[model samples]
Target: MIVGIDLGTTNSAIGIWRDGTAQLVPNALGDLLTPSAVAIDDGGAVIVGMTARERQSTHPTSTVTAFKRWMGTRQTVTLAGKTFTAEDLSAIVLSSLKADAEAFLGEPVTSAVITVPAYFNDRQRKATRRAGELAGLTVERLINEPTAAALAYGIQDRSEKEPFLVFDLGGGTFDVSIVEIFDGVIEVRASAGDNRLGGEDFNDTIIEVARPRIDPEGRLAEVDPLVLHELLRAAAERCRRTLSEQEEASFTITSGDRQFATTVTAGEFEAQAAPLLAKLRDPVLRSLRDSDIRVETLSEVILVGGATRMPIVRKTITRMFGRFPNAAVHPDHAVALGAAVQGGLKSRDADLEEIRLTDVCPFTLGVDNSAPDGRGGFRHGLFSPIIERNTPIPASRVSYYSTLSDNQRNVEFGIYQGEAREVQGNVKLGSIKVPVPPAPAGHVHVECRFSYDTSGLLEVDISVPASGLVRNLVLMDDDEAPNAKEVEARRKVLAALKRHPREDSHNMAVLARAARCYESFIGERRDMVGKWTAQFEAALDGQDPRVIDSARAQFEDALNQLEGDRYL
Candidate 1:
């Protein structure tokens, strides 16, 4: 069976096409959403989701989160004396979701359609596919996140021909997609985004504001950087959420008999987040301009992703568009649901037979060429476009060029993808060395053809008509994608790690929440939390479901009263 998975930065979810509609699959904790966190327990067993997230404060050294930002890079983190690449961490999360899906379906599911940010370059895309492979699942396709959201929205309301903009701001990446839906087709006209911009940056902003006020001397960070950062992060997250609902909230962090707190108003927070919010404008305008759709002509501006819940974000978008956006789809669930829709379409489900979806190549694909510098000289690094950004997929385009020097026997093509006018500013996917017939300067003409399929693969073909020679190549970043042998070796190492029992997920989650609360509170409240956690531990030790359940409910209620409800 095929399932759809949203391998998100802050959280991940899985869904499937069951019965007549798409439905989300719940994890062992019976929750549809799972936090994208990985940790090694004291017993060296891997724990994920809520439990792992809670331990971030107490066990900051061995836990890692938000590794998605480094997906295609060479970043690595060491957990429990073992070093893991971004791909390795991602594979673990995907494996957890795969197991959850199998349990929910009562069958083994091996194939999936995964979603990635539209702005992810070729290397990032390849890295995502590799992560899926390491998880032991066949990745059927990689759908753009905003495009997937548009598909889910389009399917729900297909009554009219409407042009809309999807503003997707997730935890670690931001994307803007201009979409149009007519008849049975959902077409994404354009997409633009910043892979490094997202909600977590806002959290960092809060941390910066609170840190100086909390520890004026800056001694806390010096003692233990990891724990200090985690505590401040947790407090900042709470304050950010509280300010979303109210006008002001207290950002507090307690350590070693001392509690540091500061009151931050919503207005102040918005002002502080101004710089990050401003980065959102360029991508939105770029997408609209590329799609040739005026802002006034857009029927609806749909908001997706957890970050859009911020009041400042919504207000900024409103001011930009001169109208309120539609929030019809659940911010946290839209991508995964849309992925399930794609899965259904891949499976050719009877109910969605007539529905057609189209996406674009989000970046320009071209090769390097020398252009006249307008001074009778040549500029060696100019970029010539074969296929421009936002062009419909399953596309092929060709551009012709001539040899730069006399008696040139070969032309080297440096394939790149970007919006820059110069190749130096773009990403070099790889290069192809093609032989050409010897000739005078600009005598022998060479043809460069670029073909991009619906599944996001690129093939470049270079032909020299004079010699009837043609060379074709598939783009591959040697450093990003490892060979089959390397993949199998990494997969085996991951498979050897023990996993925490699914049946104990509830107790683990409760303990995790209590631990976070313990770190956040001080004095009398802290004592109460310690007492409650001890009681819960004793109940768990009794091995009685009735007592453990009662203890869990009480502990949860206490935490809810102390910290209010978290956004997750």
Candidate 2:
């Protein structure tokens, strides 16, 4: 059976749909929730979950937690002298969850549907997939955390059409999603969030207030930064949690030869967290505006994620909506439970067959263009959106463009993802280049189509009618691109290609690189590169190695002159 896993920042959980219900699986410690921590014991064995979490207080240097915040970056953590990427630690936690699921179900589990923050970008989503692969699980899907919570709440089971909002405040990220349920469909109307703001930020706020008293002489600076941070964070977490239900709490930590203590009232704690609480408003307002739903129209504002348990957070939601928030699902368990529902749907279980889920693209997808600068030149980096954010998925959108100069032989389209008005502020996902018949400016038109799947994979298809050339590419992360052997294996699994000489592989790779470079240039430089490409192709047609090599050298020189030391 396909299990559902919630690989969260503070905790991870596994569950499955069984007997018409989503049942959470217990870990070796007989707990449904497992702390998202990893450490190495003295024996050099990797430990995950509760045991590792407890060790954070004593073995702070050897334990790591909250790596989820760095999921898509180049950040690495060292545990017991071994450096591990955020993905590596996540894979360790996922592996542990997989074992727990297998033990609970009494069978091997090979596939899973994992949940991530709704605001996670392409890189983060891809990293989550890699983590699952490393754990030997086929990641069937990556559902947005808020969307999963809505599924767990069974909004799709209701007979009437109802609109609601999910306010998710997790350990290291916050997300807000507007949802609608109608006719067996659970549709997310919009999603917006601050991936860097969450419960940990609140913990940090507490740390800021308690640090001065805990280390009056700043002696802790002599200790390892990681150790000091973990100690303070652990203490701050306790204070934050205690203040959630009580009026006051003690923030205390022990250093080498001294112990420090400070008492913080709830009001004071709330005052310090005001800034972080303020950050939560924008995402909620953005989601509401995107969905075009007013506060009065929302059927409910459902709260999920562990941080939402904070009384201060609940009060903020109440004041925002002028009504109490819904607490139908357990704050910590909702995401994993909803993930199990998705797993059931993926498996086509009898109970969930009629419940369909549709999610929106949280960010805009488009291309960069150039327009007249009104100074006898052209301005570049203009963003033209094809598929706007909040559009329902699986989605397909098309936009048209034309050659900018007379007899332009090739046109390049840079694919980007973001809400930015300029390409410089957006992320360049990839680019597509298609050859066009030489013609006057704006004479040869090209069509660019983007198709995004539910799994978040994107395929770009470019068609040049004037030249009858079509190019299709599946965009992938720069670091996650397949190697030669993996490419060959994938090619074998898909439709077979027509047989070609071995040299074609080398030629194709070069041409592909050249096409990418073509997208990076504009005006006269673009024209020059296009001409060099044509000449290189002519040399290859001669089938003479000497001629091809000479032309290749010239081609390389021309590219280097324009794009020095820049990889295409």
Candidate 3:
């Protein structure tokens, strides 16, 4: 069966179309949530999910998280005698989720609808697709995360032609989209985001406050640096969660000989988080402006992503829109659920026959040209837009161009994407040299057309009517982005690797959790937790699943007692 996946930065989830509704698929541990982490233990085995995240605190150098932020870049995360890119790390997560789905469905699944941040450029989108390929799945479509969230909300409401704004803040990406439900169709009018911003930054604010108190001289690097960091992070996460429930919270970093405690009130946390809150508003305004959607005209304001659960983020959005966000669709599961619905739509599921979705290109796409400013002079590098931002797709727009000078034999088609009026401020999506018949200025006219498909990929066609010459090409600007051949080669290489033992994933997760719990304590209790954690690790190396399961349950109970209600 086809499914939908939200390959989130902090966590990943999978859903499938069942009957007339989307059903979430649990992992091997029968848990709905899985941490987006990958770790290689000393045994040289690759492990993913909760176990990997827990192990990260103890094995900081061997584990990697938040690699989704590095997509479309040349960044490499090195582990286990191998240097891997963002795609490789993400493939591990996606593959683990695929295994979860397969285990639940009792079938071999080969295709999926994956979600991406709405504002991702072509390169980032392609990287997500490549990661899916490496995981042995054909990514049929890439749905915008916010749009998918909106779809999840829309499916429940029977209203028609209602406009709403979706403000999505995930673990590592932010997206603000203005959308409208026309009859039964869902159309995204505009989208804006900072690909590098997300809810994780909010957690970082807490860490910044605690670090100075714990490491005044910053000499921890010379002595047990990883443990110190683990303690600090564990405290920060607990502190953040506490503030969510009450006005004040105390975070303690106690490990071995180091002990430090700090108390922060919600007001103090909000004060420190002000800068991030401000960063959240710019995209919301930009999205409304692009879509010409006034705040009052919005029938609803939808909040998506686990970050939106933060009081400060919700308050910031309310202050800007002058309305509270709709929490009908849960922030964490909405995108994945919508992706499943989209999967159903893609497969032409009978229940979704009446539902349709259309999304716009988030940015303005155009070519560089010298255009006259109403005055006599011309402005160079002027970005002439063919398909303006917020125009619903699959769309095609054509702009006419003339020869720059007499006997001009070539037309440089410098394609670009962005909202800036100056081409230098925008991203250039490669260019092409389309041959044109040499003629006097303005005599050799050429028509350039850009077509943005449903998947948001752009293809350009340049034609000279007089010479009967036509050329078309898909744009590629970054040299690092792999082509089809390179993707296939990488996929083959990735498929050859040994799959991680899935049945042991639960043990791994609890061990990581134990490590995290161990970071927050000291003395005899710490020793006991450490001993149990080690026992489970040793048990994992044994053959009997029952032995490992028994040890895992006992260790988890020990950790729970040590952790109590404060599960840092």
Candidate 4:
């Protein structure tokens, strides 16, 4: 079965087409949501989902969370003495979700439709596809997250001629999209977002206020920074969640033998998160401006993502659109359901035969040119737009330019993305060098065509009309990463990873958690967990499934008797 996955920054979910509708596939925990976390225990067993998330507070040094923020970057996290890239952690999460889907469907899942932020740049989109490959999934498409939300909603609430505004604020990113659903087509007119802004930032706002009160002497700073930040982040996340309902939430700060109790009000949270909330306006306005959809004309304002449950977020969105946001679909499950719908469409399900989905480029794409400034001198390094922002894709646009110098044998065209007037201000995506016969400046004009496909990958073809010579290049910009080669190697590693005995996953997870519990506690508790951890490891190594299962059952009873579910 080809499934649809919402590989979110906070919690991931998967779905499949079942009985002419989308069905959410539950994880091993028998829940539709799985925490996006990865932790490796001292015993070398890898744990993902809820187990890994719980391990983060205890074994902060060996756990990774929110790695999606570094997907296209060169940053690496040191976990359990091994260095892992963001894609590596994402691959682990995707693999776990894949297993959950396979177990639920009772079949092999070889392909998937993954969703991404509409404003994700070329590198980020490439990184996402590579991550899916590393999870042994043939990624058929990368649907934009907001567009996916709309698709999920549109399937249920069929609007023939209304414009919909989608406000998506997830754990690590925010996206606003203006869509018009009409004539059997779902078209995204414009999309905008702050890639660095999201629920995590709001949590950090609480961290900024609570940290000093929690540890007034900065005593936690001298011991371990990772642990300190992890603790603070955990506390802030709880506080952020609590404020979503009640007017005030009680918080207790802990540092060694020091403790303090404080109450954080919703008003206080709104004050601290004001800047981030303010940032929510620009993208909405820009998207509406680009779509030419006035606020008065919007038929519905859709709110999405786990972060959108916060009162301030909803208030900000309502303030932007002058209407209460629609809560038709469950925020956390909508993207996955929409992705499942896309998967159904890909499989050509009879129910969705007339449904067509289209997306738009979120940013303007162009080549750098040093043309006449309209004064006496030339305006060097100016951005010349070939494909304007909000244009529908898969799209193709060509821009022609001539050589600058006398007898110039080659022309270097720098591809950039942004709405800036100058090349330096815009993001330089890649460059293409086209060779030409010796000619004077402006003599040999060449045609450079940019083709952006549905997956948001950009392909540039530079051709000289006279000689008809053409050169092509794929964007591989991460120098510190092997990029293409590393992805292939990791894909093979994922194949091996997926081959683990599925029946023993529970036992292995418990052993990994026991190791984590032992790592976190002290005195008698630590020794007890350490002993149970050893027993479980030995039982697993004995290679008999029933014996291992029996040992796990006994050890889990002992664990519950001692520490309850605190370490589970």
Clashing pairs in 4: none
Candidates 1 and 2 compared by TM-score, better number: 1
The 0-to-1 C-alpha lDDT of every candidate, in the order given, reads: 0.90, 0.82, 0.83, 0.83
Positional deviation of residue 13's Cα in model 3 after best superposition, in angstroms? 0.7
**Alpha carbon deviation, residue 205, candidate 2 (Å):** 0.6
User: What's the TM-score of each model vs. the native?
Assistant: 0.98, 0.84, 0.93, 0.88
TM-score of 1: 0.98
Worst window of 10 by summed lDDT in candidate 1: 474-483
Instruction: Give candidate 3 regions above 4 Å deviation.
Output: 221-231, 254-256, 372-379, 476-479, 534-551, 564-568
Reference-based TM-score, model 4 = 0.88
Model 3, 189-274: lDDT tens per residue?
Answer: 89999887886787789888766776687655665776566556657777887787888888787655666777888888899889
Residue pairs whose backbone atoms clash in candidate 3: 51-508, 51-509, 54-512
How many clashing pairs per prediction, in order? 0, 0, 3, 0
Estimate the TM-score for candidate 2. Answer: 0.84
In terms of lDDT, which candidate is strongest? 1
**TM-score, cand. 3 vs. native:** 0.93
- List CA RMSD, all candidates: 1.4, 21.6, 2.5, 4.3
